[model samples]
Target: MRQSVGATDAPEVRPCPECGTEVTVHPWYVTWCAACDWNVDPGAPDPERGRLAQVRRRLASRHGEQLAQEIEQGAGGGRGGPDRSTVLAFGLALLVHGVTVGLCFAAAVLIIGGWHTGIQPVLGVLLLVAVAVLLPRPGRAPSGPAVLYRADAPGLFGLIDEVGAAVGTTGVHAVVVDASVNAGVRTYGYRGRRVMFLGLGLWEILAPQERVALLGHELGHFANGDVRSSFLMHGALRSLAEWHAVLRTVNHDSIVDWFLNALTFLPRWTVYGLLHLLDGLTMRASQRAEYLADTGSARAGSSGAAVALLDRGLLVDGVEAHLRRESMAAARAGGGAGGREEREAAERELWERLAARIGSVPESEYERLRRVSARRGHSVDDTHPPTHLRRRCLASGDPQPALVVCDGPRAQVVAAELAPARALLARRVIRDHAG
Candidate 1:
């Protein structure tokens, strides 16, 4: 019989297959064989097997043996390495940055050298004039957004730590609670601190294990270095966009202005092409990262719970959006903000309805969600794979009991831990609608 660990100081011992040393299994789903430096997931299939095996082999050849091994071992939830497209995108981004700087310098040189010349002086003058129109001025680095509330409950923090450990990383540096119906991990601070934003809207509706899966997905981004890379890539793209925006804003006042604008046209178009190319090129990596996160959730929680959470979470999002619109309409009809107590009561009812629906979601409802997702397909802007693909990937993995038997005391504690954030978000809705 397989032994399971629970919340306690005492760890369960299991023998490592590679060495005779006994491995300690933690409650958070990590089993490390210190003797051989091997990390194992009790819930996953053997690393050498499954539909992902061929992809792993291809990655190993292109990237390196070590990287492929780490991904297979579930490092960062199995994000093997940057594919060919990712490599090309980064290379082109660096080249583009260099070209922009070169353009500025060339313009300055032309202005200095040809200011007193008559040989093609018009061309040189126009190129010089284009500099002012094309360059983006430096601005202050963006500050982090303010959090409406911070999660202080010990139980919630403990849960965060557990999910992080399962994905082979330290817990996030900060956990902020917000009113949005989504949760995400982002890099903050000069040191690239991983700050997790947990939406109270989702927390109030998810079961204990589903919460674990959700946390796992966010934490997995940190493990895979997805958040850090995302920050750098986006920053680069934004810089290019700023330059493009400035160039576009310059009006053609006369023949000279039109000529200067035409002079800068090629580079501006290049920037546009790069942005669209990056979006397409990075889609594969983005989709793979999402799949790896799903695996992370499954290893931390359960496959069945992870899949079910995706379905239920989608349903809840749709319902919450509809209800928010209704609340806003009612507020407008009444010509005033509702009382805090009244808003809170309505929010409570919303949660109650969500929980009831998740509990008894019919087969037809799930199919409907799948059909909708299929019709939408995966757009270039989408960061996640199709919902059906995610479900199929987890289902292909090692089969475990889909539903975990919820222990009452622990579930109650988790719910209580989230109470403060939920209450805050409730009032936020009322204020938003009134405005």
Candidate 2:
């Protein structure tokens, strides 16, 4: 975000507060010394707005600090097999699944045994409906535009496979490329084939080594045995969430509504209690799994790259803001989605442009972001430990050589492979701005 003092005015020079370095003050952008990084993030981070958000923030902070302490003391080693908490959480999850199973069984019995009774058919239908609604739905393999199967990009897949081997896992079945500024891994379909999502927003901005770090961290989830992400636990938690969602939408205008709400209150509260318990039981293990994933990133891409990978996350907001501004400016100039040629050009050039834009950010901006993280407990998102702590944890580890390296020549092939994804995302961005 840069601006001129005026069309004819020269940009002003400002002295740094922390270090008396003379710095050029670009209008509308932050004024921080490249030497000392003072007041780059001058405003307070917005407070989380609601009780649930506040609780999540506190929990993330608590877990981050505690896990960092454990790492410091060398007591955070991975334990094989399910812990007591994992066992108990799974037991509770099974009970939740069992409730829906029982409903289906009862519906079958009622429908079969009382075929002549009109009331039994209605009751059975209701039970069946409830069972259908509560049944765990298996995720399907990701498909459609921009979804890259292994055959489509062997170089990318080969790189991923090597990283997977380094982290004691196998290659992902598919790769989903999207515009989101994040990445994640998940299982899909009955076979639970794993796929990884790569957000080009994050991907384009990463250096080759950091890209390996990103892949290492996501693939590490499978090897690390993060039970919370397993189908059984995640399915149960998702089911319970649906239950809560259904229970909370009370219709407020009738005695029947009041009666139904009252009748379901106990079950609703019970489900709520179980959800909290399962979350509590898994929280520590989940946090530790995250740290293990970070370690895997370090091993796969070197500790220095792993730390830098996390540091890159701090630039997400700035990157996103720049994208929006670019989109808007292009739209106003009658170029965005206005002509086929212009749109095509953007499609081809956007990734390289984005990479260049973020790559050019000054050192002071990153420094400020690091300080802001300490003040605000910021992360890539709530699911992560604080970025600062993740960096510290990576720093504490012994430095190692990269298991998977994507050199300049190899990266060009991967870029050529991603041409389709680049076009798809560019068209979307341009069309959105056109609207």
Candidate 3:
């Protein structure tokens, strides 16, 4: 996954068995192709054929028994299942859009509405500008060699050791600041040494076992080399969004802005629409990774313990509903009028309204709501998956053959490893507030 390539050459593509879409053959790649929701080989030969063959053989073996029953009952009635319906709906949507655009063009000529003569070109140019701005910048790539460690924060050093040992990798290093309930592993330094960001809030809220599970997930990212690849992809998208934002801000006085404002608001809706699309894709992937992480944690520790931790976290956090509200608030704030303060007030009002709709609950319930808000949902910007699905995955038990060990020594080992980081972080909290 960390194999570096020079700028001069194009990466090779292999057809994915899952979707039959051409996917880049990279060592660290693990993604389903967008065209078809198939399990892709990043750089390996087609496994789909083999997989299908195995399935056929299994079906053949049971053909006389289960197949006859299934046929008699007409169980396998649908063609390609709901996926076909999804594809058909998508095609119809595109066709409808095309027809609508055609109709609009025809209407523009017949009616002297400003939408026909002036609005269209400005919208087109704004989109072009957005594309130009949001595109990723290319340069000398960051290497993955040197380890950069930060010990300034409390529990900073101990957290590193615990997480490093949990993942069985010495490739961990570096610390970054994040205010949100956001913490994760990443590659850093000139050589791209793995780094982990342990969020202050996350550390404060979750219990020891839950923390370990979270750390394990981060370690999984590092071990799998997902950090570097994600960095590159996310960096590109962030760069483009930033550029588009800057350009939009600068061009506020331009005719393009006016045209955009005329057409159900410019760049805002367009940007958000793109973000929602990306968020949908990301959420799906995140959900899958969450399941894998739960399995990984179960393998590393106790499945029962993992499940308990997830259940507790979900109960304490109330993460899902809270995140949904936050997302709605953010969207409202972004689209609202007035300055920052005014928009924030409006967002707050919206939150209050939403809370009111839920009706008055106990203090405990309110606290739960707060926890949910703090956890947040799968955002277009988020790297990790949602916590609810993670809990479900843990509850589902290990997906493969695994043992459930309740040994004291192993548990003690994990506790001992995590203690220093926890203590250090706790002290850091005291010092910050004390000052």
Give me the candidate number with maximum lDDT: 2
Per-residue lDDT tens digits for candidate 2, residues 406-431, read 89998989988998888888777765
Which candidate comes out best when scored by TM-score? 2
- The residue-level lDDT of candidate 2 at 134 comes to 81
Using Cα atoms with residue i matched to residue i, what is each candidate's TM-score against the true structure?
0.67, 0.86, 0.41
Candidate 1 residue lDDT tens string, 1-435: 112111245567888878868876644334556456454323233346576766654553343323223444455344456767789877766665566567677766766777777654566566556544444333222333324222556666666787788877777666677756688877655666667787656765678788888888788777776521565466556666766776573676888888888888987887778777776566566666777787777877788778877886657555576447646743554454554445555555545544554455445446655655654444435667668767766776686552323357877876786676565665566557744
Q: Which stretches of candidate 3 lie over 4 Å from their true place?
A: 1-170, 175-182, 200-211, 224-229, 247-272, 315-388, 398-435
- The C-alpha lDDT values of all candidates are 0.62, 0.80, 0.44
Which runs in model 2 stand beyond 4 Å of their true positions?
Answer: 1-29, 32-60, 79-85, 335-344, 378-381
TM-score result, candidate 3:
0.41
State which candidate, 1 or 2, has the greater lDDT: 2
**Candidate 1 all-Cα RMSD:** 15.1
